[model samples]
Each structure stands twice: as C-alpha cells, then as structure tokens.
Target: MLPRPVVPAAATTGALLLLAACAPTVPVTAAPYATDPVCAAVVLATPDSLGDGLDRVATDAQATTAWGEPRDAVVLRCGVEPLGPTTERCESVTTPNGPTIDWVIVEDDGDWTFTTYGREPAVQLLVPGAVAESRSTSFVDALGPAVARTEQLRQCL
Candidate 1:
C-alpha cells in the first residue's frame, strides 16, 4: 500500500498566485450622456418644467406612442427623446397644481412602474375651466421648448 504525499504550503501558494495572475480583469465604461448647457437645460428640469435630468423620455414616448394617445391631460408636462436601444431619458413635473416632480431615466423593456407621493393635491390645475385652460397652456408652453431641446439632443448622440 502506498500513501500520497502532501504539497508544501510555499508550492501551493505559488501555484495559486500564478493562477490568479492568469485571470482576466474587465474594465467598465461610464454611461453615455452629455452634460452641456443645452442638454442640462432640458435634462435637469423641475416640476412645472420639462428637461433632461432623467433618462426615460424615450420610454415614456414609446409607451405614449403605443398607447396612441395624443397627450395625457393629467400629465402637467410630457416629453420624450431616444437614448440607444434599451434606454430613454425623461423628466416630468406633476406640480402643486398637479403635485409631484419626477426625473427618471428608465432602462429596458418598458416594464417599470412606481407611485410617487407629494405634499400637494394631484389636480391637473389649481383652478378649473378657462383659468385651468390658461394654466394648461402655460405648462405646454414651458414644457414644449424643453422637450424640443431634448429631441435635438437625441439626434446629437
């Protein structure tokens, strides 16, 4: 009968070190985005405004496009722009009149959903009828330019 000999600690350690040296290390790059004045103005928007702080505009637009709804009345601001194959950049503000601001860059599959809470009530406008009509128009007015700028940004990339 024969017994196997144990390897010495130094030899085992050297073999392990050699194996570790052969392993690969991958480098991850940063997400693609531009932080210029035009992009920032549109991307870093607040409630009652439209801009690019978020990256889900394209997702919203795709959902909107699929929904086939011209526009959502409940949404104080609606804007969309593309960002590669599986992502989109979006910024929206549902204010005191409407009541919350959401800036997001959703990724892949159009399956994300979450509810947000705010201090103010979720009314489309503080007042109703003609007064609200004026307000809604104002929202569109403020949001339009930002949305347009975002659209141009999508092309830039």
Candidate 2:
C-alpha cells in the first residue's frame, strides 16, 4: 500500500479563492411587494456607492430594498403612504448638495425608524439605532436625490 502526498494548505486556499472568483452570478429573487412598481426602478437605478459599510441587497418586493446583512440590515421601502399630521419628532435635513428631506423619527430601544415626512409615496428607512446616530447624515446625504426624484406632495413647514 502507498500513501498519497498532501498539498500545502496555503496553495489549497488560493485555489479555492480563484475558483470562487470565477463562479457564475447567482440570481437574487425579489421580495414580495405590494407597493407601486415605479419604486422598484428607483431602487434598481440607485448607485452602489451608497456608503462605506452598506451593500445593496435583493428582496422580493418592488418597493423595498435592503442593505447590510439580513440579521441587522437597513431596509428602505419606497412608495409608502405618506404620514399624516403627527406630533412625533419630525426633522428636516438638507443634504450637502442642497436637497432637503423630511423625516419622522420613530425610536425603539436599539433601532430608529425614519420615514420621509412630507413626500408623496413616502420612503421609510429602518436603521440600527447606532448607525442612525452615527452614519445617518452620510446616508441621508447620499439618499436625498434619489428619494427626491419621486416628487414631493408636501413639505415640513
């Protein structure tokens, strides 16, 4: 009986990496959606340079998109019915490029849900509380234009 020689682990790992890089693109199914289809186009047309730590994800809905991992993700839902008059902490932010977005903050223990305040077919973003406090400005700064394209039927006074 003869024993076989083993290849070095480093070379084996490199081979795996090369194989993975050559793998075919996997299809991501859309999430179940009940909102307007136009919102999907807005989402699909959004650039990938959203931010430093976020990555676009495929869901089953036309009006919904998600970023980051499923466990703790930032979910954006467009074409939602806008919020009516409320007494919550509604804030307006002007992006660096000069677009203003209105948002109503819904705070939970470790999550902050922000919904566009005065836009038709509003946008709702569910971000982790930590990310909301830290990178929210950056995210909103980038997201303003895209969301604004949907048209505003109202404005925060």
Candidate 3:
C-alpha cells in the first residue's frame, strides 16, 4: 500500500487571509500644531494682552512669498458671529508650512494678540466641542481648543 500523504498546518488555506483581516487598522491623521502648550493656549489671549502689529501676521510681501504665496488659511472664530465683529477668539496658521498661531481678536481693536506653542512642556487639551465638529488633527490639537474656549467665554456674555 502506498504511504498516505500528510498536509502540514502551515499549508492550510485561508490562514494568511484570516490573519490579515485580524490585523489592526490605524487611520492616518494630520500632525498636531507644534505639540507645545503655548501654541495651544488661545483662550488666555485677550485684546488687552496683545501688542501692536499683531494683526498682519503673515501679510508682509517678503514673508508671504516665503510662506507659499499667502493662501487664505482657515480661521476658526468663536464667541461671536463669524463675519460680524466682536471680541471673538480666533486661531489660524500664519503660512501653509509655518507655525499655527492663536489669536484673540476683537473688532475695532488695534492690538491683535496671538500665541504660538513652542518646544517645552507639552500639554494637550481636547477642544470642548470636538465631538460636534469634523475631527481633524489641526482642529483637535489647536483650532478646537481655541474655538471651544471662545464658545465657553461667549456663553458667559
């Protein structure tokens, strides 16, 4: 009688497929704004806190060119109507690849105070309204914090 052939466990079909399906999936996410608490600190900034020439953050022609032609970076403003003027807290990226700066700007105010997180103690805060808004790294780390803070302040007013 011919010897019976044996099938090895490693040769089993669909084992690889099963393993692939079981592997964890990690969604790709954008990088946070500098990972510094100072950059993330937008709520503390007030109109009174800012000095002169803070409004035109990236407007200088020379600066603009270096920052990729000055694209209209998204600005998250809370505490008041977006277009209408008020003491709304605002945060935006100065340039596409530049640092993310937090600003507390009020209408008719000459001083536009801004803050940027630097390397040091890293403190991460979840924006108050993060769940309601579309989740983005920038929003979660920077925009959300500022907007959430402004919203909180607006509720008081």
Best by TM-score: 2
Q: Which residue runs of candidate 2 sit more than 4 Å off their true CA positions?
A: 1-34, 133-137
For model 1, the superposed segments whose C-alpha errors exceed 4 Å read 28-157
The true-versus-predicted C-alpha distance at residue 60 of model 3, in Å, is 10
Global local distance difference test of model 2: 0.70
Model with the higher TM-score, candidate 1 or 2: 2
Cα misplacement distance, residue 5 of candidate 3 (Å): 91
Question: Per-residue lDDT for 82 in model 1?
Answer: 24
Please write out the lDDT profile of model 3 over residues 1-157, one tens digit for every residue.
9999987777665777687666433221222433333323442332221112112122211101011111322222222212323355644444344334443333232222222222122222212222213333233232333323322211112
TM per candidate comes to 0.22, 0.69, 0.19
lDDT of 1 by residue, 10-77 (tens): 99999999986664322212112322334345433423322322112211311121111112222322
As a whole number from 0 to 100, the lDDT of residue 87 in candidate 3 is: 50
Quote model 2's TM-score. 0.69
